[model samples]
Target: MEKDAGMVLHTLFEQTARRVPTLPALQWKADSLTYEELDRVADAVSGWLSRKGVGRGSFVGVLQERGLEMVVAILGSLKAGAAYLPLLPSWPTEQRLEILDEAGCCCLILQSAFRCESASFTGAKLELDDCRALARVEPPPAERAEVLPMDLAYLIYTSGSTGKPKGVMMHHGGTAANISRNAHLSCEEGTRCSFSNSYTFDVHVADIFKPLSVGGVVIVTRDIFRIPPVDTLSTLPSRVTRARVPRALKRIIFTGEPPTQASIVRIPSTTRVLNIFGATEFFDATLKIIDVHGCPSKLQSIGKPLGDYVPLWVMDPDSKELLQSGAVGELVVGGLQVSRGYIKRPELTSYKFFQAPWLASEKQEGGRVYRTGDLVRLCQDEEYEYLGRVEQQLKLNGHRIDCATVENKLTSIEGVSEAVVVLRDGDLERGQLVLVAYVSPSSAAVSVSSFRDGLPAHMVPTRVVGIDTWPRTSSGK
Candidate 1:
């Protein structure tokens, strides 16, 4: 839409604000803000951040719960030409501090309600209340930086194999391309989309900006299950249930994990279920609109690439050679949706984000493509059937958990020499999967509760078992 080749995300929001200044932009509980109101407040935030020396190339840490304030902080950071890094309050204090330090954040926008000791951060700190107060007073005119499309827009930290979270550096151009494609394909004017995902999750970018970019409203709430009917709803497949499905829901997006045939049949035929397959490295790359009446085989496919902006290919995991149709191989994603690579991780970035020699003659964006570790097979009609990952990563409750990260944390515990983590069926009767950690030396007294402090709830193992010996195949001497 509108030649998004070099567009910036916030610029689209500003354009929509000017078009429909009185339209509702965001609503949370009893609080709400019109386009004009939200735009003006975001300008004030940008002014405040600008005064604090936060401009292009700067990183702003956002520490707030999901609500109106979080959206303001995000918009304000973008308007100030600085990338916003989401610092979840639920994370351990040390984890949050580590992320902020890694990103070299120049400013932190923290909500007064969220308590954490940020004395370690040698940067400007502005409370959300102060941001609100600034909106009440006329902000001084400050020269706005010329934020370019290639400028960094945000930093999202995903679980890493090195026992630390890695920040994904996303730029304005790629993010804008993703939001524009999704909005043009699914959203409409004045569409009301539910903001259900956490800000730390990359999908939240689509949930919030997708609607705002199209003069639509973002229904910001702590619980989407309790919200009124909205034009679009995005959530995990496990969260979908007959009782929780909103009435009059038009479209529901399922991602994070594959949806079962049983889960698809529960939705009303009138509603469209879009099973999106994507990663933090890139946004929504492929989308499959489930046909409730179709066969079970069709439901298993993660439909074709979203548009020309994101091109998909299947390649040999070892040789990195492109594979033909019907051959199962790693999924390679190329085009504008590809992120700017991981922050401060050039080795990993170069390995994962590389230019395909075959595509050198083609018109590819930046001549870069991301090697998604995910394995897949190209099916008929240009659809793809997911065949799991080549690495030991698991998706639980809509969040990707690196098994190596969990194992690393387990080994860090006292008395534990080595650790291995695996996803197993915890409840066979309910067909539920759970993470279980196995440590060497059966005598190692490791408590599962200890992991709760360091890892996210989803990444923590449900049980820890000590094993005296490692299991191996019969061929192993």
Candidate 2:
């Protein structure tokens, strides 16, 4: 616990770089960077950003594809004492502008390809070419900002109950705690980790930060074969079960969604399968190391809490009463991993996060707890069996889709009066999940093209069906 105190992400990377300056820090296709080189480049970015009046209490928007440049932008943002906000390239231009404006981004680090997309942005823009040129030049000596553990480390946007995206503010202390715990669990000096997740996803933090914190190598490439065999891989369950996994992969982590029995059985016996349960609001809260040959029932559980750093509780949704073992209730997470709540959303933050005096003795984030909105029952063994969500939220592929948000968008369509969104197994043989939208007024016409232009790819319903009338309960919903 003492070691976990006051730990920051960039400071940890600096420590590791000093210990292993010549070690490979990042590798993408034919290019690579040693720890010393990456540190210098990140410093250059920090200096450049400083010259542009970007520093502490600033938000740096990172809009670039996954590669060496992306990693540099992230580390450079941290080095500049600013939180990096990742904007997906696939998002609609309007959606990108909305987030950039909402976060009050002070600067944007982007590639030439996204210049037109971000032309409407009001913040100062630093292109990838600028970062490369800065790396080659000698950076001037500048005073580093005094960054604290509670300072914002990054901001990840997720679907909100309304038709907007909410930013989850993660601090350096919590991020470092999760990274240290994960690295201790699987990483060692010189271990190679595969970086496959999109930078927009929260899981990318574990994919990149976990390894770099422990003097390990991060293989940043879409093709696994392009780089040397990695020791560990973190990705969605669908990808690993459907595609051929690398034989040399020793450990595999599945998150975003639960892993099926068939998927777990597909992995080689030599590789360890760890199913992680968490959300964008928090890092990993619970983890289960799957025994591929064990009883299938074991795989149904989301395992125990991640040691004492994260505490899990079950409480009645209506009564707000704590439930004992074997009772089903909403899962509550409290610890250093709990984020600082949504950006500029006071009402939503107050509704989702609340104080818990009982947790004070545990020294958890001033006794703050986040309601996960997930229902689960505590097993006799202290593990948890995941029940369905308290709401209509769905996790398709690896992205979380809020049904209300999609429905809100649907209602905005000219002809749509009422709408409902759900997940269906469009291809049972391949175990693929598809989003379906059901709208009222059978005569109403809905076009998938319109949805494509208005919504993100994952949020677009694959099938839109018009119903004459909706079935109602006895009391009417």
Candidate 3:
């Protein structure tokens, strides 16, 4: 293989294969596949896809839940020289079909047991158990084909909070580098990871793919995410000693809803809870590991960058100039691990990814940076303290409102909004936190005091406002 080709997925597979061939590569209930077994299965799946004309540059969808089948199908697609698109089982069947239609999937590798007749697709349908049977029937391959670093490895879709979900195109080199770096830091034998997030969330990229790629054990629990916060806290840690969470970056089991007594007792003494801070743009940046020893800092800071591939800068929000180390400004990311752009959304891509003005050298390759709509303060200790989202900081009755803080408060509010609220800053500090009109003012006649009664005092809004109309920009964001 060429030198550049050595940085992709198959290369990592070879390393894990050498280190622990008999080690458990994946485990779900009674089914467990070793590294050697997984490799052979990938080979057969690749051969099958190759026969079906799903090769390099082809798009394939893996629609399944968190199980041994999901792992095999993903590896099979990669081995077949096609990009894998993860179809989240938690999503409505129609939503999954929409993504399948948009991406133009050549084939959908799904589990026969979970297959719904309504899922629309023009591609060939392959079942997981049948594929496993095929894996046992086919002969082993001589060697896996090499893939380029810039080749598309997977197209991860964003949560469909805005109108419809969109896919983000990620290259193999960047994805491999991210997984490799995370594996070297987080995984080991008997280290069970609570693989909780849906595949669509980028959290899965690091949570599920990174650990398994390194031969670590992952517990794929199918529990619905909305089981009471206390119930989740109590039950989640029992399955895995360590878990990855999107919020609560600085502290674990504290922020969303305070863990109940039952929840606290469920935690293993050695369990390590990692509150990860990242976006789809950068896979995993800063992470704070909290365990029986207790967390070391306040509850909001996102820690620091992980591995050599990440570079962070705090800059003036308005000027786009790099701020002094201790100054508060916008957080900018420039790194090899960053995603290329949103698939088929050039106008949206241009809005987020931009030329780095702080970098004096114009010739620096990969110098283009992403302007994360976050406001942060650089501490003297060289850590980024997340102030709030720049997009959510709005003026409400002359007071600066951090939408994140409000949202956190609303998470505890009972029967107020449909539990879905978006804070729009008309201008800095002048914004409204709009509810989806599930609760009417005339019918409920709710007061600020009642809302504050449901949450911690700081989260209560200064003005309980209503809006009948909202103007949109050209992009409808």
Candidate 4:
């Protein structure tokens, strides 16, 4: 198989670094690193790793909190021709060990003072505090090792439906394609992004590398993504947020879940709110910008496919037949962004990634496709409306019910703040799945009986459990 003529990630970083040596590449609270300075530092990092026996195809584990040090570790690891496995300091020791063992990590990167509690891994350790010593060692050149575009750029582990975290391997080409597709992100043009999302999350993959790809700058704040939406907006500088005033931020890129009405109102109406939908297997499947600025896609829609790089297909889950517009089916994504596959899981990778049958009939092209397992429909305008997960569809009261419909209906009500519908043990005699809801302010003027005015009686929640907040993970599960 011939490799595509794609540029490696670190190679792209070098192009921008040379093009804009004086441009601010990264800015934290008080310190900012220019492109030249960052390149020098990354080179030093590469040399440090090289001396520690980290080379091409090596998986180096990174367990530092979000900071300038973490950035150095990532770029440096890539420059050294090794894939960086990012781990949060907050993750459980057991989980960290599992990832370490599963990926067969060759080394670990962390701050000098940082240490994982109850965690032990037999790998060479590199610390950020060694920058001074590394700088004195006459560091090796950035081009010393060859890391091809098809080589693994990073491995982001995400918890699957089975409640186990698995690493998703992303090659340089897929990541580079995403950055190139979103090249307009350059902070040089005054359009910048706040980098607060956890390094462990794939969303951070773009926030960290996209700017460097375009000689743009990214504001790095510690654990900014973990905080609430309101606080995250405050970290952006005036220059970045000046375009979209009254919101205190430039472009707010949100993923994982839809933003709540309460959160939306806080953002300035003019601020570009981009809703990104993606999985570990694919960097970005759809890019939907929600605003009244002549944007055609609805707020509920996931917008059109990202670019020519990634094509969309709504396929019948059972027959694998392609569906027409407005027909609900599984969302299949195929293109350069479709990943190589899951690491060390051939069965899962084969099941998830495959050549789509629709390619022969609809596209007239040949390529592997990742079955998203997300139920959606293509609108008349070619936009796709998200209908929740395929597993989200459950059987209740002998009706193939979609809980998303019920939850969406409830949230659509005027007074309700948020709503989550869960399945409980159904009635023994009726043999129907019971729907339980957990929402705040149960008496928020929502009539349980009147709520059923539009929804089927069976779709209504069998029980309403009031709560101040829903129990969720750090990712807002």
By lDDT, the best candidate is 2
RMSD of each: 11.0, 11.0, 7.7, 4.5
lDDT of 2 by residue, 362-455 (tens): 5545588999888789998989987556777688989977675576566556656567899988999999999999976667788777667766
Q: What is the lDDT of residue 172 in candidate 2?
A: 90
TM-score of each: 0.80, 0.80, 0.75, 0.88
Model 4 spans > 4 angstroms off: 1-5, 116-119, 130-138, 141-143, 185-190, 223-246, 292-297, 360-366, 426-433, 441-445
The clash numbers for all candidates, in the given order, read: 0, 0, 5, 0
Q: In model 3, what is the error at residue 378, expressed in angstroms? A: 1.2
Which digits, one per residue and each the tens of the lDDT, describe model 1 over residues 374-410? Answer: 8788887778987556787678878888675576566
Best by TM-score: 4
CA deviation > 4 Å runs, candidate 3: 1-6, 113-120, 139-143, 224-269, 291-297, 360-365, 405-477
Give the alpha-carbon lDDT of every model.
0.80, 0.81, 0.61, 0.72
Cα lDDT of model 3 by residue, 1-477, tens digit: 123323776567767777888887665766777778877787787777777888778889987866777777888888888889998665677778888888888999987765665345778878876546878776544455557777888898874336557688877776677666666455655445545555665655555565566766655555424221211121222222123332322113221111222223334554445545667765566654444444323334666776445788887778788888777678888776667778888987887777786665755546877877788777876667776678666554455656555543442343332122344443456444432212222233445665565444444554454432333211111
Q: Which of the two, 2 or 4, has more lDDT?
A: 2
Clashing pairs in 4: none
Give me the displacement of residue 208 in model 4, in angstroms.
1.2
